[model samples]
Target: MKTAKILKVATFFSWFACIGLTIKSGAILVTYLLSISNPEASKNMYESLNLFEYYNHSFLNYSIIVFYKIVLFSVEAYIAYLVIQLLKKLNIKQPFNIDVHSLMRKISFAIFYLWIIAIVHNTHIQIIGKKHNFELSLFSSDFVFLSLVIFIFAQIVKRGIEIQSENDLTI
Candidate 1:
């Protein structure tokens, strides 16, 4: 009983994390769109958008970039943890139920779509000189591929859970 309750709570957290990911993903998409729509305007806006000067040293800019990367990485890591919990909830020992499978498929599809969008956005930044030289296209591609694989695995697990549920119901 306690484990069930814990699983439920974890699922809720996963949903919450998904929401945050969606918001952050949307922000990145919007920024990318804006940049593409008006490159000159985007450049001007970025140049004028000064959050902090930090005693006239340029190191602050790099620090801020590092901080943003750290936060983004942390969010991604949390989402991955939540995804694992969700997969555990599927209890993939049995298969035949449709509900769990369907839900998992939808989530997987959404995540894949989001991954594609992120890759596109990142690529756009790299092309536009907004990203650093260290940024590689392969990195974005790998992230998208990994996300797709994880989501697909989740869907497979959910399908198993559904089948189990159906067997239980029939018996």
Candidate 2:
């Protein structure tokens, strides 16, 4: 009963999170397009890019860094969507449903993908961000451990579904 109530809350919160993140993504898209045309748009976006500190900002360099930021935010929005799906699956009464296991697996995969994107993105940022004296967290061991745990939990969910199905057959 307690778990069900918690799942219900999580499902609704996930919906809210998904909507908010999608809106933020759309706003970033608008800003990115606008930044292409207006000179001031570049300045506005350069709020903290350290453009002049390390090297002069060329349109090409500014554009690449901006695009990378947008991609990173888009990944965050995608992860939110995956979380919503996982939460909704958990909201279902049947804890051993195959769909639940599938959602967990998808969530784990999304996390792994996000982890990879971060590493690759930060690598470029390090080469560039460091040149400008920008603060950067290039990698996270916390994420590494969490990703492994989530992936293992997904496998456990898969095993639970199989066991439930076998139990159903016997009855």
Candidate 3:
């Protein structure tokens, strides 16, 4: 009963996060388009994030960076959606189901992809900063560990499923 309650709470939070991130990504995309016409639109991006200097530096680089940022948030929103699905489908009594295992694997892969994009985006920022002689930083390479942890958990769930299958056969 407690586990079910906790799962419910977790699902709620996941849904909240999914909605927030989706909003953030959409806002960024809209701002990007608006900034194309009115440069003032670039002043405050997606809640006071000022990338105006980046825009001033090089339009191409700015576009690439903004694109990466949008993709990062979109991926995060997708991961949250996947987590909500996993939480909804999870049964505390018999938690090692194929659907749960698959969701975990997909979540891990999505996290890994997010980590890769973060690294690339941050690296791009660093390279551009160096070449252009301006300091700018973005993204952290922390999601890789998260991805690995979830991947290991997925594997453990897979093993549990196998064991449960064998036990049923023996029974």
Highest lDDT among the candidates is held by which one? 3
| Residue lDDT tens for model 2, 88-170 | 66635577777777877777777777777777767776886677666553434245566778889989988988898899899
lDDT of 3: 0.92
- Deviation in angstroms for 170 in model 2? 2.0
Q: In model 3, which regions exceed 4 Å deviation?
A: none
Better of 1 and 3 by TM-score: 3
Q: Compared to the true structure, candidate 3 yields what TM-score?
A: 0.96
lDDT of 3 at 106: 100
Off by over 4 Å in 2: 46-56, 91-93, 132-142
lDDT of each: 0.49, 0.65, 0.92
Root mean square deviation (Cα) for candidate 1: 9.5
* Order of the predicted models by lDDT, top scorer first: 3, 2, 1
Q: Relative to the unseen true structure, what is the C-alpha lDDT of residue 110 in candidate 2, on a scale of 0 to 100?
A: 72
Q: Whole-model lDDT for model 2 versus the true structure?
A: 0.65
- Candidate 1: stretches off by over 4 Å: 18-96, 130-146, 154-171
TM-score of each: 0.44, 0.79, 0.96
- Residue-by-residue lDDT tens digits, candidate 3, 102-121: 99999999999999999999
Winning model by TM-score: 3
